[model samples]
Target: MSSGTSNGEHRYVIIGNGIAGTTAAEHIRKADGAASIKLLTNEPHPLYNRIALPPFLKQKIARQKVTIHNEAWHAERNIDLMLEQTAVRVDPLAREVYLASGATLPYDTLLIATGGRANPLPNANGLQNVFNFQTLDDSLAILAQIERSESAVVIGGSYISYELTEAFRSRGLQTTWLMRGPRFLRRVLEAEGGALVDRIAGRHGVQVIHGVEIAEVRGQDGKVSEVVTSDGRVFPCQLLGVGVGITRNVDFLAGSGIETSSAVLTDQCLRSNVPGVFAAGDSAEYYDPYVGHPILMGTWDNATNHGKIVAQNMLGGEVPYDDVPTYSTTLFHNRIMAFGATPESNPDVEAVMWLDEASESYRRLFFQGERMVGGVIIGQRKGFPKLIDLIKQRTPIPVAEREQVLAQSVQ
Candidate 1:
């Protein structure tokens, strides 16, 4: 940690060093030059884009390129950054945070940007091969294993799993994807979109299995040899990759008096239920205007936006974050862009699909009556912003023009 001038004044402490926490620190520094700020992070390195880990593993980009900023940037701004330190507890009433090393720090305002942790495989049972893709260390370990192995078994069929499968395949490794659902990315994409992804994965020489739950990992000499599924099937693989999803890192807030449900519940201003406390990034379960319910968005965009909002609110600036939710992923020669709430989120909503299976192109429009709700685009990159605009403005498309609009390119 860098030393700062002893002004002997109240300071703001930010937990976590991801995009959200760093953004808050930057915003606070810009708002009040004299305000003291300290950022505590468990990771030794500076904030970097977690979403870019897969691309880095594939050697498509350098690790330094994904890093947001360097330590010198924080030091020049007179901001104290305590890396490799964990905040174990928070006393919300007293506005103080207790560290794992028994150091207590007082804060005039606190922001919980602790983010989320990768969900571990069920029945780890001291299995050595089971691994998750979340941090830089996890990616490095997986990359090393992929280089030494010729085959891998990946659990979960979400975006992370898809990326890992692609990474392994790019390295000349045979990969198998295990999904518990009937289709890949069923929660985000429709059947047609999922099918398109499945075909793409198959084209890359990857095997796909659905409706099977991994029961246990059988190992030899404390290293994984095979994985047994609930259906009594055993998969032989030297490497086991698990990407089940993530859980909010809110365990430290157990006695913080912050209202949490899967994640810390925050309002439009990014304020927690308790005053002088704010939450953001993957740990914040915020109310979505489109879905009209509290949902946890584990995306890079959400983290950055939430950080800006929380920072403004901390400085007594009124700024509401109500942008339309959007996310995109690329895999196996196809790109998928999705926004707002999917049709599955609302049963009353309906979707219309325009697909060319041979060309592997698909366009899905989700609607509630004449108003556009949410949808996805596959194998096409144009008109993404138009869809976002329509969703944000709640623009309605006439039934007759719906198909034409979906096919048109914005000028």
Candidate 2:
């Protein structure tokens, strides 16, 4: 972005102090000792582990353990951390960012890592006891509600909904998981995989209701009391956890020349269409060379890698992001893992599934022609590393031997 200028003279302005932005600032400072770096975040606190929020909600970890970086940490690195400041608009032509407080900051290069905001449930705003867990504050508030809550209702089939369902059930509350789809991860997992997850939830005493949408939220004294579905069935609860997914925070870039579709569109180098501008983290929809398409991934590993890789490109290096992103979680003593591009990410891939009801293990491998592209495993983590390596190598497996590959690990 800063041509002919020394690295020391470049001014880097990063929006959103999440892991991606913070990691970029850390690396930028390492390479360019005298570069002016400004990290802005609307949140009051510094970089905290969003992944740690679930354990914090379940009271498995103390509040202090959730924070990954404090203000002092930023100060020690000489990174100018701006807290509680929201970027309202960007003018690419002027290379300036306008803040919500009427202040403007000029930058030689800018990174839009603002990530995504949790999607709010309809007719649930302004009501107490209705929660969306996206931040430390949200987790804290939910913990307080759990102290007095006798029952909980969770909506959506996303990971956040599952987190709420698990946390509520762990706390011994009467928990019910409701979704409009017939199975969990309907787009990614087949009926066999979904049924395995349902059985695990059932074993943990969670009442899972399918094929229902919230018609109305009834409250008492401004606090949520019951949720009525479209089928006229009501589920009563003192707390409601909604995980309807998220919308990337790119509205401020609407008129800025930067391309955006669900997220900021970027090439393999994580460079936006506009000069001197780039995107990372959940706010980036970058081209994935492995899948031969651009997919938006919100996992911590993907975002962290984006920060490091994009920083090289920002420094005038042509580095393509080729990391294989994976996400793993435990469900009532069983494991669930997803790797690379699944049906949810790339629908064109063919799928082959393997199941063992007695051992409570199931796996579905996805293929693009003869090469493995992605996989999902539930209730078993035995063959995870091999599958990851296969996807990374894009290994071609003979159609006749595909079923043998599925059962090789456990057998």
Candidate 3:
């Protein structure tokens, strides 16, 4: 198949309407006015804010507020919006995408942004009151269940689990946080960091048990009633929130020759091994030039930036993604911020840490040689912006000045 149509106009087909794919579609329309753009998503609704779902669950925001774009928005830009269409196969050689609905789409350049599916756990299948908090629909169903729930159990140790913990506690549900790992963010934060999180959750009246896995869930009347752990302990609850992890949606590319490890493997340009095929968002594990390795960051900011950069590259620009990725969110009443590479993601880097139990604050800086690569700050936000600048510029800090930098950052 030819790359372009008979008249030379380009065809762009993007899968997944998350921030990554949607942003790419928006920018592509801006740059190439005449390009035929088709945006696809398996979801039934238009583009919505996944980040806001937590707040919506807490009744801080209305359901409609979570939506970022309406169908009319795509119509205004003359972009074809295809919803509830799951791409089942990709014929990269023929530049065609086969959908589950028996529809075929041909593209000159294709962007695979089908983000991910929530990883399911055993006993969660076909079970009522057991939920995965990954989508707007999940959150909505959870919100409805919360109205009838008196107790909640949150599983996993990732950010999603933390969000579930906070939401349940905020709603006055007797909440129990369960994790197989010893602590939260086990890979990124140390024991002291985990203790801080425990203290925060405790202050909010949350029961946190660690190093235990879910053995079996006991239900009554087709609804979850209690959970039994591997250690043979049982905790009664009306709702279960599972945030184990996510499986990147790349199964359709199984034989399409798209190189994938944890996700679609792309270079700094966000281009897959095959020409004219690109990836973005959580689906793309692109090589990070700054970190000197391939990394997958699934933050909204990272995905949004990926869309912008990938759009330029898909339009024949050789631009490489260089944005510094950062994530900042509120935990209970405190702030948790992390940016760039961390000890969890890159073990080769050396780390320095400081903690103050009285103030409930902690800071850890990661260094490679003399340059600051990444850092995590919990509690205070005094020097977060400065640290981002230092990492972005690759500023060098001498060993003698390392402690001084940390002390001054908090002030």
Candidate 4:
């Protein structure tokens, strides 16, 4: 952590050094140059893109390519950055934060952007060769294991699992994907989308096991060898990758007056229930103007947007963030994009789809009567902008024109 003397002057303290906190620091510096600004983070390195870690693992990209900013960039702006320092507790009433090192720092305004941690496997300690993909450290650790092993078993069916499986396959490792659900990406993608992904993974020689759970991971000499499933099945692998899910990093704010349910509740302006306290990124559950309720979006885009909004609000500007939620992920040769709420989340919706199983191209437009509610596009990224516009504008595309619109060039 960088050393800085605390003064009695008004100060802004931001926790979490991801995109949210970094962007907030920049915006605050721009709006109020003289305001004392200090940023604390648990990570040792400068802010980097967590989304690009998969490509980095596959050797398609370098670590330097994923960094958002360098140390010199933050230093030039006069932003105090405290790296590898964890905020253990928050005294909202006292307007101070207690670090793990026993240092108490005061703040006139606070931004909580701690994000989320990778969910652990149930009875993880009893299991051997279990792993999770979340931070840079985790990615590096998994990459090391991949380099040393030939066969791997992945437990989970989310996008992270899909990406990691592809990475393993690209490196010539025999990969097995074990899922408890019937399909991959069950939470984000519809049945058709999940099937398309499964087909793509299968084409790449990935063994996918559906409706199965790993009961125990058997290993020898502190290394994994085989996994026993609940269905009386045994799969042998040298490595295990677990992508169960994520839980928001809000445990530190347990007794703080800030309101939280699932995540720290914030208004459209990114301000918490407690004045002068703001939240952004995965740790913040904010009300979306489109959805009309507090929703948790753990996307990088949402984190950046929240940082900008919270910075403006902290500087006495009344800027409310009402952005159309969007998220995308790439696996092997397939590109998937989703916008707004999923169809499962909004049951009062109908879909207009254009599917060509032969070409492996699919597009589904979600609607609530005449208004477009959301959309999912697989194998075609060009369709994202137009679909996003349609959802944002609430534009109605006639059932007959759905195919024509999707075929037309977005450019």
Tens-place lDDT digits, model 3, residues 186-225: 8778899999999999999999999999999989988999
- Which residue pairs in model 4 clash with each other? none
lDDT, candidate 2, 1-411, per-residue tens? 463245447888999999999999999888988888999999999999998998888888998999999899999999999999999999989889999999999888999999999999987857899999899889989999999999999999978899999999999999999999988888888888888889989999999988999989999999999999889999999999999899999999999989999999999999999988999999999998778889998889999999999888888889999888888776777878888888877989888898899989888888887778888887758877887888788788887777777888556
lDDT of 2 at 116: 95
User: Residue 333, candidate 4: how far off, in angstroms?
Assistant: 0.9
Task: Name the 10 consecutive residues with the lowest summed lDDT in model 2.
Answer: 1-10
Residue 1 of model 1 has an lDDT of: 19
Once fitted onto the true fold, the runs of candidate 2 whose alpha carbons sit more than 4 angstroms away are 1-8
Q: Go through the candidates in order and give the C-alpha RMSD of each one to the true structure.
A: 3.3, 1.7, 1.5, 3.4
**TM-scores of the candidates in the order shown:** 0.92, 0.97, 0.97, 0.92
True-structure lDDT of candidate 1:
0.82
- How many residue pairs clash (N, CA or C atoms closer than 3 angstroms) in each of the candidate models, in the order given? 0, 0, 0, 0
Model 1, position 76: C-alpha lDDT score: 84
As for lDDT, the candidate ahead, 3 or 4, is 3
Tens digits of per-residue lDDT, candidate 4, 180-246, equal 9988767556677678878988999998888999888888877788888879888888888888888
TM-score of 2: 0.97
